[model samples]
Target: MLKVFLVEDEYIIRESIKKTINWAAEGFSLVGEAGDGERAYPMILKSEPDIVITDIRMPFMDGLELARLIRVKLPQSRVIILSGHDEFDYAREAIQIGVTEYLLKPISGATLLTAIHGVAQKIRADQSRIDYRAIYEKEHAEKLQLERTDFFKNLVDGKLSMSQVLEQGQHFGMDLSAVWYQVMLFQVRGRDLAEAVRPEAAEADRQALEIEDTIMDLVAVQGHAEMYEQIGDTLCFLLMAQTREELQQTETSLIAKMKKAAEGSDKLLYFIGIGQAVSRLHEIKMAYQSASRAFSARFFSDCSGIFRDTDAGFLPESDQTELDLSRLNMDKLDRRIVYNFLAGGTVTDVPDFVRNYLTGLGRDNLNSLLLRQYVILDSIFAMAAFLKKQGISAAQLEQFQNQFRNFNANLTLDQAETRLCQCFDNALALRDSQSQQQYGRLIEQAKGYIDTHYACEDISLSTVAASVHFSPNHFSSIFGQQTGLSFIEYLTQVRMAKARELLYCTKLKSAEIAFQVGYRDPHYFCYVFKKTHNLTPMEFRSQRGAKAAVTGGTDACG
Candidate 1:
C-alpha cells in the first residue's frame, strides 16, 4: 500500500482532511501529519511517503517549500497543494514545486478523494515498477549462482572415473554416490526470435526448465534417473538403465515428450539431442558435449527436430572423404563459383545440385562457414530480385551490386578458406583487439570498473561510458566486441558473479543482496538470476549450502 503524509497549519483542517477520506479505500495510509512545512520535511524524507498533501501557506515554511524539498529528495512522491486562495500566483508557485493538484482550502470530500485516488494510482504504478525490478534482480542473481555450482559439478564429474568418487567429491564440493544424476540441454534457436524475446528471455528460460521437469516426470515412471539442465541451452538425463537398448528407448520417449511440449510455440521451437548412455558420473560432460554438438547439427539440417548421433543415419561415418575446395587456386573465382551455385540453387535446382555434389565429396569435411557465406550471398541476390519485382529501379540494384563487389574485393577468399576452421576464433580476436585499441586501454580495465560500479543502481552504458570519456554508442560497440557480451549483459554477469559469492558465503536477504548488486528492485534481480542460472536465489543458496556441508563433513571424516 502507498503511504501518505499531510502538512497543514490549521489543526481542524489537517484532522478533517485526514479523517474525511477513507485512505485505505484509496489505497494509502495516513503515515503522518504536520502543522507546518518545516515539521513535514524531515518526516517526508524519513517515511518516504508516496503522496504528500500540504496547504499552500503554513507557519515556519510554506507548502511550496515542502514540495520543492520533496521534489529534490524523493522525486517519486506525488504532491498535492491546498490553499485558501486559488490565485494565479499561488497556482503558479505550486506548479513550479511540481504539485500534481492545486486545490482550494474549502475542498469537498469528493474533490479530496479524487486527488487521493490520483496519488494512489501513481503510487500503485510506481510500486509495480519496483516490484518487477526486484523480481528480475533476484532471479538474475539466483541464475548466476546455479550456473557457477553447475559448472563446478560438471567439471569435477567430467574428470572423475566411475569408481573414483572420493577424488571427484573434492572437486564437485559434494558427496555424489547417493545423489541421482540427469543432464538436460536447453537449446535456444531463431536469432530473430531471440532478439525479439530478449526482454522476456527470463520467462522463456523458466518455461524451458518446466519442460525439463515434465520430461523427468515422464521418465521417472519408468526408472530411476537424475536430470540436470546445463548452463548452455541443453538438457542432460543420467540414470541407470537395464541395458543399452532400454536407455535408447527411454531417450526416444523423452525426446518425443520434449518435442510435443516445444512444438507450436510462438517464438521458439525445441530440438533435443540425447547422448549415448554412460553409467559413470564422471563422463557426464562428455555426454553433454556430444548432445550440445548434436543440437548444433540441427542448424545444418531442418529446424524443430530431435537428433541422436548414435542413432542410425544421424551422422555419416567419420571416414567420409573431404570436400577438396583446396584445389581451386583462383580465390575470387572459387568464391564466385560457390556464390553463383548457391544463388542459382536458391532460384532453381542448379545451385542445390552443385551443393549436393560438393556435399557428396565430403559429407564430414565441408566448410559450414563457407556454406553460410554462400547462403547469405544467395539470399542477398534473391532479395535484390524481390526488390525488382516490387518495382524498385535497376539503379538501386546496381548500387547493391557495387557494394557487394566492394565487399568481395576487400575479402581474401584464399586466406579466409585457409583459416576457415579458425574463422570464428580469428574474427572474435580481431573484433576484440580493435575494440580494446579503440577504448584506449586493456579490456580488463573496463571490466574492473564495471565490477566495482555494478551496484550503483543507476549504472548504465551511458554512465559508464561517460566515466571512461567514451560515448555510450562507442563504448557499447567496443565493450561487446572486447568482452563478447553487450553492455547490460556484462554488467548483469558481474553482478551475478558477486551475487553468487554472496549467496554462497553470506546470509544476506535477497532484497538486500539485490541492492548490493546495484539493483534497486530485488524481484527483477531474481528474475535475471533465474534466467541466467535456472534457479531462484534462495534455492541456489540452499543447494550450495547443502553441498558445502556435505563436502565439509566428508573432509572432516577423512
Candidate 2:
C-alpha cells in the first residue's frame, strides 16, 4: 500500500479531505494529517510515506519548501501540492521542486484521490527499477556468471538430478520451482567468413545481444517467458507455461516478432528450434537437447524458419521426450548393415542401411547425431574381425585402426557417415586383395588334382583339398574365386567330360562308361548325361553312328 501524508494549515479542509475519502480503498494509507507544513515535516520524516499531499499556503512553513526538502531527504517519495488559484506561481515553483502533481483547491475529493494514486504509481515504479538494477548487477558478477553458466549447461546435459537442481538453483537466483518449462534453441546463421573472424567477432557478439534484447522485448509483452542462457551461438530459452498450448502461443508470437526484427539486417538471419513442453524443471535438459538437434536439422529444412521438436521429428515418438538408450533399436540397425562383412555379405546396402537408421531415430524423435556416431564406433569389432579373417597384418590393422580412431574428428551426421562408409570401403577392398594373394596358389593345386582324379568314384571336395594340404572350407573359398565354380561343381564337370569322350570313341556300354567316370550308379549317370546334353549317353552314341553311316564313311576314330 502507498503511504500518504497530508500537510494543510486549515483544519477543516484537512479533516474534510481525510474523512470524505476512503484512502485504503484508493490504494493508499493515510499515515498522518497536519495543521501546517512546519509541523508536518517532522511527521513526514518519521513516516517517510511514499506520497505526500500539502496546501501551498500553510503556516510557519509552506508546501513548496516542504516539497523541496522531501526531494533531498527521500527522492523516491512523491509530493502532491494543493494550491489556490492565486498560488499558481507557487505551484509552478513547487513543480520545479519535484512535486508529482499541483492541483487547485477546492479540489474535489475524487480529484485529490486521483492525484495521490498517480503519485503512488510513480513511487512504486522508481523502487521497482532499483530492485531490478540490483538483481542484474549481482548476476553480472564474474564469479556468479561462471557458476550460473555451468549450472545451466550441466542441467541441460542431464548431469544434474532434480534434487541437485533444486539445491543449486536457489544460489543461482533461479526460481526452479516453476516446474513447467519449454525450451528453444535459436541459432544465428549465414554469417560471412569476415564476420566470423576475430576482427568482426565483437560486432557479431553485439548483434547477438541486440537480438537477445529484441526477443526479450517480445517476451515482456507476453509476460510468461524468460531468457535462460546462451549456449555458444545458440540462445537457449526456458519458458514457464501452465499448458502446452500456452507455451506454443508464446513461442509463436516470440518467433514472428524476432523474424521481423532480424529482417532489418540480411546478415542477421536465424532459426528457432522449439522443444516440447516438459512438466518438471529437471526435464528441461531433455527439452534443450531436443531443441538443439531440431535446430541442426534446419540446415536440411527451412533454414530460417521456426521448427518445433515435433516438426523436426527431434523428440521421441511417445509424448515422453526424455532421453533413453533402451528405446533405440541400434541392434536392428546394425544387422541391416554388414557389421560382420567377411562372414560374406556385400555392403552395397550400406547407404540404405544408414538411411533406415536415420529414419527410425527421427520417427522416435531421438536426438541421435551422437547416437548414430556411437553405432558406427561400436562396430569397430566387426571391422577387426573381417581384417583378421582376411589375414591382415599387424601393421595393416594398425593403419586401419588409425582411420577408425579419427573417424569422429567431425561429428556431423553426413561427415560421420561419410567417414564410416569410407572405412568399410577401404576394409572390403583390402580383404578382396588379400584373399586373391593368400588363396590363389592353393586353388590352382586343388584344380590340378581334380582333373587327374575325375575317374575316381570317391573323389570329393574334402579328398581333393587334403591332397593339396588345405582345409576343405579354405580350399572351397579359393576354388570359387579362381575357377568361378565350387569344388563339387568343378569335379562334376571333369567326370562328365570323360564320360562323353568314352561314348563317342570306344562305343562303350552306357553302364560301363558310367562306372569308369566316377559314377557307381548307371541310372544317375544317364540322368546327369541327359541333363547336361539334352540326351542320354546311349542316344548320343546312336545319333553319331547314324550320321557316320549316312555320310558313307568309317567312324572318325577308325
Candidate 3:
C-alpha cells in the first residue's frame, strides 16, 4: 500500500479527512497527521511516506516550507499542496517548490486520492528503473571487466600499438598518460601447496579463491592501482604514477595492503614481486617481464615474502669470478630436490625450480666441465628414475633419455636452463596426464559400484566413495566434475530410471515400484516423480497406456 501523510492546522479538517477516507481500502495508509510543517518535517522523516499533503496556511510553518525541506531531505516523497488561497502567487510558489499538486480549500477526498495515486505510480516507476539499472550495470560490469583484462594483457604483451592502447584505454575510462608505470605480480597459496602429499585437503582450492578475492578487494579500494588476474593463481597489478618515486610509494603501499589482507587468513601465504618502473607505455612489457622473473622466486625462496628482479641468481659477481671448489658443499647439491619437485611441482614451477636447482650447485663450480657433466647427469638420472616409478612406458623413458643425451658440459647456463625446463615441463605434463587417466578409471569403478548398489536404501555418498577407495569430500568434487552431477543427484536419477522401467514393463503397484527403486515412502516417490517428469506416476502410466491402445498395441504390464 502507498503511504500518505497529512498536515493541516485545523483539527476538525484533519479529523474529517482522516475519517472520510478508508485509506486501507483505497490502497493507501495514513501514516501520520501533523498540525504544522514544523511537526510534519520530523514525522515525514520518520514515516518516509510516498506522498505528503499539507495546507498552505498553518500555525508555526506553512506547507511550502515543509515541501522544501522534504524536497531536500526526502526527495522521493511527493508533496501535494492543499491551499485556501487561490492567488496566482500561491499556486506559482507551490509549483516552484516542486509540489505534485496544488488544490484550493474545500477539496473533496476523491480529488486527493486521485493525486495520491498519480504520485504513487510515479514512485513505483522510478523504483523499477532503479532496480533495472542496478541489474544491467552488474552484468555489464562483469563483461566489461573481462574485456578490460584482455586489453591489459595485450597492453603488457606488446600486442597493441601505443595509439591503440591509448584509444582503448580512454574508451575504458582509464587514463594511460602517466609518466611512470610498474607491474607487480602476486600469488596466494593455501592448502594447494600441500595437496601433493595430502590429496584429501578439503576446501583448499576454495579457501585460496576466497583469499584471492579478498586481496583483490583490497587492491580495488586502494584507488591507486589496477589489478587483474594474469593467469592461474597469479594476480597482476599495474600501478601508474607521475614520477618513479611516486610509483615506488604506490608499490610499497600496495604490497603492505595485500600483505595485511592475507594476514587475515592463517591458511594463506602470499608473495609479491615489484618490477622496475618504466616511463614509456611500450616499456610495460619489459616491466612485466622483470616482475615475472622476480615472481618466479616464490618457487626458490624458503618462505613467503617479496622479491625483486635483482634477486634472481645466487652468488655475487665477485663470488662467481673464481672457481671456488672449497666452498662448494656437495651436500647442498642434492638430487632429492629434483625428485621432490617432480613429485609435487606443476608446469608453472619449472623455470624457477630449474634456476634454483642449478644455482645451488655453485655457479663458479659449474664452470668446471667435470662438475657440470656430473650435475646434468645426476639431474637426468633422478628425472628418469622418478618417471619409471610413475610407470611411464619404457619406450617413452628411452625417448626422454635420448632427448637429453646431447646435454654436455659445453652448454652455457642459459642453454642448460632451457634444456632442464623443457625436461621438467614434459615430465610434469606426463605425470598430470597419467593422473587424469587414473582418475577416469577410478570414476568408472565408482559408477559401477553405484549402479550395482543404488537399489539399497541405506547406500550413500560416503559408502559409495569408500567402495572406490576415495575420501568423501574428494570423491564428491571429482564426481561432480566428471559426471556433471552430485552424488545424490546421480543416485536419484538412477533410482528414478529404474522406477520408470519397472512401471512400464512390470505389473507392479506404485508402492512396490517405489520400494524396488529404493524409495521407502510411496507419497514422496509420487511427489518426486511428478516434480521430475511434470506428471504423477498414475498420470504418466495412463497417458502411455492410452497411446498404446491408439496404436493397437498391448501394454506389457497389462
Q: List, residue by residue over 500-553, the lDDT tens digit for candidate 1.
A: 988876789999998899876676778789999999999998887788788775
> What's the lDDT of the predicted structure labeled candidate 2?
0.67
Worst 10 residues of 2 by lDDT: 336-345
Worst 10 residues of 1 by lDDT: 342-351
Ranking by TM-score: 3, 2, 1
Inter-residue clash pairs, candidate 2: 315-365, 317-364
lDDT per residue as tens, model 3, 122-184: 877677566546534643554466568779879888899989989999988888888998999
Indicate the TM-score of model 1: 0.35
For every model shown, what is its TM-score relative to the native structure? 0.35, 0.36, 0.64
Q: Which of the predicted structures, 2 or 3, would earn the higher TM-score when compared with the native?
A: 3
Cα lDDT tens digits for candidate 2, 257-330 = 77776656555557787777788876887787666655544433322577766643323334444456666654
Best by lDDT: 3
